[model samples]
Target: MQPFHPIPVSVLTGFLGSGKTTLLNRILKDPELRDTAVIINEFGDVGIDHLLVEQSSDGVIELSDGCLCCTVRGELVDTLADLIDRLQTGRIKSLSRVVIETTGLADPAPVLHAIMAHPVLMQNFRLDGVITAVDAVNGESTLDHHEEAVKQVAVADRIVLTKTDLVDPASREFALFTARLMQLNPGAPQISSHDEDAIAAKLFDCGLYDPSTKTADVARWLRDEAYHHRHDHVHDVNRHDARIQAFTLTHDAPIDPQALEMFIDLLRSSQGEQLLRMKGIVAVADRPEQPLVIHGVQSVFHPQVRLPAWPDDDRRTRLVLITRDLDESYVSRLFHAFTGVPQVDTPDRQALEGNPLAIPGYKS
Candidate 1:
């Protein structure tokens, strides 16, 4: 039997007329993306006429650049499972990666949950990252009116500013728009759609381990520094909606595993819908030598992975959370309670576990 190797899956999402398909069309032409399977919600929605080579009877289209394109027949999980079966049965000669292009108006959390929570898909595939495309012309308006658009930008690993050529780079409006995106997602690097160097190499492989170096790039992966720097720039409180926030929580001491579990359970159970995305590296008291990594979308979390050792000298536990309509104080208080940090009026873990409502701002 051959050893199983999980394929890296990247999700591409954006708002209506955000140029997701345009970016994808360009990405498919890259030679490095060969043997990649592009799963789109609908074939009619995506314009792939220039790249189409031949269509198979099984609904898979062979692209001119050696990539494969398939539309979802039903649930995304079914489409993903079918890809796995095709790989195992020799139907797909080789599959290096999978890129899922979500519908423009869709919230990407459900797609992330499908891969992160499913038992079978989890084993065969690993979530590479989320790449969100924001239209330079109407992005600000889209984010202003649509909550889904805000969530899309908040949870992105790589934000591609599409149709940038149409907007003036030095204009005040464009600057404000870019600044808004930075506030929403400080860690994700923003790349222009027309950037000559924006190829497959730069957009993908945003997981814990760098494919090129084959090493855990913890600092780059966590990017807690970005959140810390966001405080330096003072902006009008009403400039953007306060409901969506990106922040980082850090602790120097190792956390008790049970306490950590309880804190996470309470947060997810009470406010899952508000939690757009959560990723962290924790120093556990039981095994301080090995750090545990956690990634989640809403309430669905990938199984905890214990790294052999701390990737760097910074052994402190750092959690980056992108939340919507969730107060940072609420999360901070919960963390303090679980970690045994005393607050004037906040209840400790023992008391909070008895009644989770004890947290000052927590709402269920």
Candidate 2:
């Protein structure tokens, strides 16, 4: 009736020849993904011939499984606007979700920025999750030489390891590749693309949405345990490659909403470029029962959402940050300064004078 509901948009990305097309083709065949609208960066990459595509008025094509496919011939904003217009006009009906498949050489941060920053698109769509495809046979080499490949894995909520059948399961190389992926992104769950059930279960509904009940799955989406578990494990020698790091910040006390706003604003203005991705569930002091859900990529942040109730008994404010060049101490110190929490050591007059903004107790 009203275009169904606010659609959850998922970003599917991978390096060149990482089997993104293969996975996409397979997903299109699934009846469960029937109500999805797919936006491919290039039309040539997808095969609409095999698909029983019903001709729509223009660019848009309806597949036999009841999905929609379109290409980004111009700007992404224009393409999305066109789709939303059609939905409202009753030309396209029963849209549940949308998937944007980015070019192999593309960086997903810009695409996310466009979606979150746009006024029209923001009203109709909510970013669900980022799913990245990695060729198990060549993922190691790709990460070694391509910064884009590293960022793709780092920002993903779920990683699909493709072409795993090409390598021996018991071989040392396969094991090493798996370990490397874990090191690079310990928070994201890794599943093989060959398993159709696993692919559907792990990838599609991984964001804040719970597909089984169509509700918010805040606890599962945050995945704070993945970062916590990695902390207790042995550190890899190559963990610090490319100045990329992942860490979690946890606080037992509730924080003032204004203070939280100031902290995030300062962080984004100062070191936003180094901030690859951030996600957290916070307990606001004024409303502890309704936790705030915040997520950001690079310099842009999505409008924070508040859940009706806490998903679990744990009410601690936990934030997981993945940064390219930022350090844990700097982020913690910055957060503490705005919250008026005492730092481990009081800054001496000379030290405070050197960098006045860093000290909460500093006075002009």
Candidate 3:
């Protein structure tokens, strides 16, 4: 179903003790979200944000902060269905946007899939973007041990580094943590949670929408240039935990659509579990001006979005892949084979004895 006046929904996720709730409280106070409604896991924890608004008998609490807050009583679907119903009826007033705060331990992939895959929800709600909160103190350890924590960072469009106040500003620890985040996910823009004034502006308008023009913000949404030439060299700091690795592949020539599909299929089939996230803006050979935007989480992929025109001068097929326990050479070989391009090997890389793209054992 085509979205007719579809509402934008942003997912707020983070690891436990990452200060997700703290950031959410700050966002709730923003006047920009006056027309927005928030759905959180628990009411008691978030209720304090709206100290001025009296709690109603029903689950919904009208915040003097200008947004409505509700607890997820049961499944997420039920909560969303109820919101839609209220919007359709006269129960809710001026509801334009929605935000769902996932539990700290939650893996955000399923939450994104739920919003994008449901037929009813798709018609009324579209995924705006995902904002993940990363704790400055425990982020590295969390990402090192928990795959769930890695997924949260991998799939985010925007990352908010929280608890920076606890650490010294001049400390190398914060700087090091930022570097790890960049390595894990280079496409996302990181904002300091303490920068409260900039939070609403940076986090909102993150999706494909340009509120000023009411058109797709493809360039801003896909910031492909950020990944250009990044990850060219492996760093000891980022390589500490080899379990999760991120790499960007660029092609100057346009690609065949069929080949692109095949490459994704092969990768998913072989390393679907390890493939944490794949995001790209491909330039098609047939249509140079129009580009295909692709995003996937694990085995599930959101439908490809084709923009009306090229967002900028750079017209290369740039793809950023984040995987867990997956070899970079294996992924490089698959992409180059499908695109019909030559793969370059570095001097330090373990040369694949037989195959040019990868080692002999990589071919499955």
In TM-score terms, which candidate is top? 1
Q: Model-by-model lDDT, in order?
A: 0.86, 0.80, 0.76
What shift in Å separates residue 219 of candidate 1 from its native position after superposition? 1.5
Between prediction 2 and prediction 3, the one with superior lDDT is: 2
237-353 in candidate 3: lDDT tens per residue?
Answer: 454345676777788899998988878887877677778877778898778688887777777776777777766677788787878878887788768767876365554143533
Clashing pairs in 2: none
Q: Which of candidates 1 and 2 reaches a greater lDDT?
A: 1
Error of 1 at 359 (Å): 1.9
- TM-score of candidate 2 on Cα atoms, chains taken together: 0.91
As for candidate 3, its clashing pairs are none
Give the per-residue lDDT digits (tens) of candidate 2, residues 66-98.
888898868999988888888888888778889
Q: Local error of candidate 2 at 72, Å?
A: 0.7
Clashes of 3: 0
